[model samples]
Target chain A: MTDSEKGENQEMLDVFFEASRAQDPVPGSDLMARILADASQVQAGFNPAPAVVSHPSAGQPGQTLLSRIFAVMGGWAGASALTASVCIGVLYGATAPDTVRSYLPALDEQTAELDYSYLGLLDETVADLEG
Target chain B: MMPLDTNDDISDDALMVLFANGDGQAASVLAYRHTGRVLALALRMLGDKAEAEDVAQDALMRLWKIAPDWRQGEAKVSTWLYRVASNLCTDRLRKQGGKRASEDIDNVPEPKDDAPSIESDLIARDRANALQAALETLPVRQRKAVSLRFLQELANPEVAEIMEISVEAVESLLARGKRGLAEALEAQKMELGLDT
Candidate 1:
């Protein structure tokens, strides 16, 4: 098209294009509502799930104090072993075994003498034996 | 206290991120901000308000879905919406049997009696209807280029991005499309009050 014709055509089309702009439709309220509802629904999936926080020092949140103590003592096995040891100690103390007295120095003036000669044998060198 | 976010100043890109992070207010703000333009473009493309509304809603819905993966600088959210709405309109246009839903310009509906009756308002409405009718005559790509470039008042490069074509290609299509529109409406010029 000639430049003159082109300018004329553009001018004419500009009018129509302008009218089209003025005529741009407003979306109805229902449409806006639907759009937002869709957005919200889709966004529902986007929310990061709340982090599961474990308190390091709080043990288990719901466990009883006795249960926590049991856990600290290594469950039932440790508790049973501790109970058995306490009972054995009580029996030995009550009965006053000579075997127990043999290891410890006497509370009275008399003492259970421990031999140092046996320790001297342990100190003897393999070289002395070989010689 | 942090001031309540009017979100008026927030860019659409940031709004999309907030939306993805489950900020309902951000979604609300972005939806209101963009859906109108998207609807307008779809209206131009499909030439039917209901269909255009459907296209707009679908585009935003896709935006919501894509928000989690939205690469902030890759494309503006509004530009992305335009591209999505344009593509959706294109799909529907193709399935339209290569013919407009309203085939005859003669059948363009008269304004409702309940509508505003100002002379200028009526004139502008008539002219728009005529243009819309004429637009449906060109090929889909031509129509899209014309709508985005002229009626929607988007820059050439932005149109290219939306159409996924080069700016040069967009200019060429616009040239041809305007020519086609002028020819189609030339016969109706006097009726449309373009004789001025």
Candidate 2:
């Protein structure tokens, strides 16, 4: 951690490095050849696909349209889940009396009114669809 | 989309890609370039030539198998190979129940006489033996960090990348490993007349 400690470590490392560099590693020529031979044998087992083409016309337009609609619905569902989680977290923080002290308590009244208006709109939309 | 050429200058990653496409020669080149480093690391870690050879071969073979899925520029090929080879050596060492009793290096075969003068060869061998003994005393991770950083001449970041640790962690390991080696080598130093 200190400068002297760092210098000593570096010096020792240099000595070890120099000593290791001086020693020659024995070659394994036959082992290397065998390994490559085995590798080639494994490579020979692979069968690559030839060139191919796909026609968009092979798919029906109606099926593609339905797939897009389902994809959009899935995206909406995910977004709704995320939004609901955020709203729940916010609401929980807002309503908890301890956390309420950290913010302007007067703002909660106006937020409740806005929440009612939003819920009323949801109800009306659902009722009209059911009717 | 260009055809891969064996004689052309290619990076290790490119060679890996060619090997993936079934060019055995590309694999051979990679093996030639990296095998010595891997074997040397394994030899230091395992202290047995036969096991080191097995570890090196297995590590290189894994490269050939994973060539198709290898993402380029992510890691140096030799660095990755050292990591794999070291891991294999560690696994074998663990399975064999920690360190084997130290063997007499006097029986170990020396390189051909043409490589070095007899006196120099003896001195180098003695130093190498002292290093090996000192290295064996360190814990496995420290030994690996020291070996990769010092022996392989890999930079700190490359050593950290291979060891799958942060740079700070690598530094700590190297510090501890070096101190341990220095302590172990002190007596050997007196014997080798390195005190002067």
Candidate 3:
């Protein structure tokens, strides 16, 4: 189209565009309330209740880090099992218990060979066991 | 906590990050700023206040949902909103499969005594309604293009981005849309007070 034609088209449409734009909705209080409500509701999901904790920051700042960890670990029952596991670990480490190694007697073959000579242990041990 | 009023001075990207970080005030600030812009576009596309409001609400809801993952500086809040509102309007228009022809003539504010003649206000309302009527005659894509380009006053590149089409495609749609609107308005120039 010629410049004049384009100008005419734009000019002609300008009046209508102006009028239409003037009547553009202002988003009334009710509409605003609803939109804000929806925002809050959806944001509620993004920032959920503190108890369904997603991160360290999601819990109460007043609470100790240890308590927070316990809360995250499923409360008293988890803490109880965790406590038992810790006690067992401390006992095992302090005493260096060998009952488990005694049960897995075949492991003795490897440990015994590593201590002495593999050929002497394997042959002597095999012969004695067969006899 | 950044004060919600102070958030007005902050960029939208900052506000989005604040919102993602669980700043309740940030949501309020963002909502206060962009809901009207989104609603205006949806209103033009849907041609019904209630439906447009619903679309606006849905669009804002989506923004709230995506807040946690809102990568700052990657996309603008306004552009993202316009794109979302435009798509929601398209879905609604397609589902309706027909023109939505109501404009709020009844809701036009009562003319004040100090204002110009009530007749002028009436003329302006008539022209707006007529333009809306003509807009309804457009294909949905053209209607969206015209609304985003002309009514929303967005640049062609931005319009293209919102419409997810090439710049040339946006130009084509707009040219065709303007031509159609010009022809429709030409037939009613006298009624539109353009004959003066």
Candidate 4:
């Protein structure tokens, strides 16, 4: 087609299409609601979920008061400190068994007098009892 | 308190920014502004109202999903939406083995009797339905180009952006599409009372 003819044709199509354009099919209300719902859902992702109050339950019986204290002491550092404390207590108990005995008058004299000979005497007493 | 008119005036890019910032009203504003165009394009492309509604919802859903990542100045919001809607319609069309559910002309929505432009409205409605029928007969790309350029009144560049084609390619498709439409419309002019 000639340039002039093309221009005229385009013009006619424009008018024809303008009418078509004006008659945009009204979207059903249900569709709009669904689309809006989709929008809300996506936007909801940006918000943080609501915080729920935690409660002690039967399943977590191991969460004793001491363990709870250790947990509250914060993460690995606190846990290491708690473990170190328990290790120190155990070492003191094992290496210094007489420390508490020395504090008691009844154990004080006996513990002070205790020697390797006492072990031999105990062994003989056990043999006599068995015999 | 933000004035509601301010929301109305906010650009799509700004509205998107607000949406990303967790402003719920911004999403509503954006949806209200563009849903009609998206729905119209899908309706014309699919020739099925139900499918068109699906496409519209899907496209807007994508829009909502992409709000946070929406880049300002990268593309026009309408262009992005129209492209998404177009793809959805294409997918639906493909699923039916490339056959559109042929719409009976009688089922075409009639102009309301109380419409001020009743006479003209009737003519336009018939012509529009005829055009839609003719559009369905074209290749998918041609139909999309013609519908975007003529029916949607998008500029060649805009149509190209939505179709992901060069403007020259868009023009070519539009030319060929218009020719096919002309032929189809010519055959229907008598029955549609275009001559009268």
Model-by-model lDDT, in order? 0.83, 0.75, 0.82, 0.80
Q: What TM-score, computed on C-alpha atoms, does each candidate reach?
A: 0.73, 0.66, 0.72, 0.72
- Where does candidate 2 chain A have its weakest 10-residue lDDT segment? A54-63
Top TM-score model: 1
Model 2 lDDT per residue over B1-196, tens place: 4443435567998888777887757766787778888888888887777777888889988887778889999887887888899889889888988866355663243454454677866766777777877888898999899888878778999888888999999999987988888778767665664656
- For TM-score, candidate 2 versus 4, the one ahead is 4
Q: How many clashing residue pairs, candidate 1?
A: 0
**Candidate 1 per-residue lDDT over residues A32-120, each given as its tens digit:** 99998998788877775688896434578798888878878877899999999999999998887787766765543353355567767
**Candidate 3 lDDT over residue span B1-196, tens digit each:** 6677854689998888887777778878888889878987887777777788889999998988898888888888999999999999999998998756466654342233443667877786788778877887888889999998888899999999888999999999998998888877788998677876
Each predicted complex: what DockQ? 0.41, 0.23, 0.33, 0.30
The true-versus-predicted C-alpha distance at residue B54 of model 3, in Å, is 0.7
Q: How many angstroms is residue B8 displaced in model 1 relative to the true structure, after the best TM-score fit?
A: 1.1
| Top DockQ prediction, candidate number | 1
Lowest summed lDDT across 10 adjacent residues in model 2 chain B is found at: B106-115
Q: Order candidates by TM-score, high to low.
A: 1, 4, 3, 2
What stretches of model 3 exceed 4 Å from their correct place? A1-3, A52-131, B103-117
Q: Tell me the native contact fraction for each prediction.
A: 0.79, 0.43, 0.63, 0.52
Per residue, candidate 1 scores C-alpha lDDT tens digits across B1-196 of 1122653887778777777776778877888789988998998888887788899999999998999899988998888999999999999998887768663453333344445558977887888888998998999999999999898899999999999999999999998998999899889889877786
**What interface RMSD does every candidate have?**
2.8, 2.7, 2.7, 2.2
Error of 4 at B58 (Å): 0.0
Q: Candidate 4 residues B1-196, lDDT tens each?
A: 3454465887899888888888778877887789988988998888887778788999999998898899999999999999999988888888887796668753354344445676778777877777778788898999999988877878999999999989999989988998887777767666665445
Scoring only the second chain, what is candidate 2's TM-score?
0.89
State the TM-score for model 1: 0.73
